[model samples]
Target: MLILAATPIGQAADASRRLAEVLASADVVAAEDTRRLKRLAAELGVEVGGRIVSYFEGNEERRTPELAAMLVEGQTVVLVTDAGMPSVSDPGYRLVVAAIEADVAVTAIPGPSAVLTALAVSGLPVDRFCFEGFLPRKSGERMRALTELVAERRTMVFFESPHRTEVSLRAMAEVLGEDRSAAVCRELTKTYEEVARGGLGELVEWAAGQEQGVRGEVTIVVGGAPSDSRTYAPEDLRELVAARQSDGLSRKDAIEQVAGETGTRRKDVYDAAHS
Candidate 1:
């Protein structure tokens, strides 16, 4: 059997009872960070009795087969990441696939999740949503990626690095509309936990004005685009394209983003820009 347990994203007390029990008795424990796992076990007051093995992104490919072999040998294997559940923007998906292919029964211990936690507190409509893990790091790539979701009607969740939070918000404001609603959740469930809620423009300014700068693990929740497609005047599309250009997107990419968001033809946007 393969067990995927959820560890606390911040507060150690958030660890589930089943997680503690499993940690203490699994036949093989695969952890993204063995050191962190040991510390977490000590904090939970549960001495791990299983053979602990490192299983992280760097070694997941190599370690998966070994862990799966243990499962094939009838041993109970538990997979855990440094925080949250295994395999969520983490290093457990490969192992899960291996387990299933080996016909090992798989299950999970429900616990804290930064994705859902941020969404629930984001004050956005949670009726329908999507998790977008992390945005591309480069400005051009990031702009192109956000451009694809400009018409997305489902609330979007994203994990971002603290250093890039301000720039990301600025890019979002430029492409997704400055008035788009969003929330920046930082150090969730931790000592400095904070949730800054406002429009994308406001968030960009807030992140910029931070004297110490945005710090800690960050999750961004942006409200979905309005369901009804609104028509945009040629001039409006031109201004949108200019905004993206000022934010570092090339003229071509900017036109593409504006056309995509406004449902305008690329040629029309180009004429609007130069006309």
Candidate 2:
């Protein structure tokens, strides 16, 4: 059997009862960070009666097969990460896949998660939302990814490193528009947990001007585009009008073309053209 356990994101007491029992009795415990695992075990007052092994990003490829083998041999393998549920932008995905392939029964001991913690506190509408785990570290790649999400209608959540928080928010401001509403959740469920909410532009400025760099994990939530009026600029409308005109469209046809292409009023495009 393979057990994927979720530890608390912050408060030690948030540890689930099953998590404590699993930690205490598994035949083998695989942790992303052994030190943190030890600390968690200590917090729960559970003495691990299992062989502890490292199963982080560096060793996942190699360790996964070995761990799966243990499960095949009928050893209960417990997998844990630094925070949240395993296999969610964490290190247990490969091992879980291997276990499933080898016909080993797998289950989870669910606990706290930063993604849900941040979303719950975020002031944005959460009736519908999507999780975009992490953006590409490189600025160009990150911006490109954000561009594709401009028309996304569901609130989006993302996890980011503290050091790159400001940069990532700024890129989002550029692609999603400065006025797009968002929240930046820091150290969620922890003592220093902070939720900063505002337009993307404001958050970018605040993050950039902070004298002391941010610390700990960050989850960012950006509100979706408005259900009506897709926020197309006059310049964008004009560009569409010109493109259609070049495609042999008459002035009336071009106006309709631009309106249909951009979901803007034909009169708005005409005013933009003459102004």
Candidate 3:
């Protein structure tokens, strides 16, 4: 049997009752971070009677079969990450696949997740939303990715590193429009947690003023393009492209993003920009 448990994102009290019981008496426990798992066990005041193993991204592929074998032999396996539920942009997915293929029963001990935590607090409409785990690191790749979402109707959520929060926000502002609404959620569910909401451009300046770089975990939630954006004309797209170009995006990227948002063909926007 395989049980995926969600750990408290930051608040220990958030740990579910089923999670504590499974942690106290599983045959084996696999965690993304062994040290964090130990700390969680200590905080919960539960004795982990089972063997503990490291099952993070680096070794999950190699260790999946070994863990699966244990499950095949009727051992109950508890999978956890440093925070949140297993396989929610975490590394427990491979092990889950292995368990399923080996004819083992798999279940979850659901608990806290930063994704839903951020979404719930964000002022943006949450009725429809999508999670984009992480954007590409390079500026160009990041811009390209944001451009693709310029016209997405559903509110979007993204995970970004503290060091690059400013960069990512700036890219989003340029591609999505400076007036686009967004929220920067930092250190969710923990002490000093914050949710900064405003126009994307305002958030960029806010991120820039962070003297010590945005600290702790970050989740960015940006409201989607307006419904009327799809009816924009070529002249309107040219003006939009010029705005992003003024914001330091390359001319090519500006055209690409403008075209995406306005539903205009790239070549059409290109011709409009030249004219």
* Model 1: per-residue Cα lDDT over 1-275, one tens digit each: 99999999999999989999999999989998999999999999999998999998889999999998999999999999988988999999998999999989999999999999999999999999999989999987897889878988899999999999999999999889999999999999999999999999999999999999999999999999987657778888889989989988789988888877876778999999988
Question: Please, what is the whole-model Cα lDDT of each candidate in the order they appear?
Answer: 0.93, 0.87, 0.90
Off by over 4 Å in 2: 229-275
Error of 3 at 34 (Å): 1.0
Model 3 agreement with the true structure over 1-275: per-residue lDDT tens digits: 89999999889989988888999999999989889988888988988999999998889889999999999999999999988989988988888888888889999987898989999999899999999989999877887898889878899999999999999999999889899999999999899999999999999999999989899999999998788734666678778889989989889988887777776778998998988
For TM-score, candidate 1 versus 2, the one ahead is 1
RMSD of each: 3.7, 6.7, 3.5
Kindly report which residue pairs in candidate 3 clash with one another: none
lDDT of each residue in 1-275, candidate 2, tens digit only: 99999998889899999999999999999999999999999989999999999999998999888998999999999999999999999998888889999999999988898878888899888899999999999876785577567667799999999999999998888768889999999888899988899999999988987789867889999998777767778887777777877878676667655554455666898887655
- Candidate 1: what lDDT? 0.93
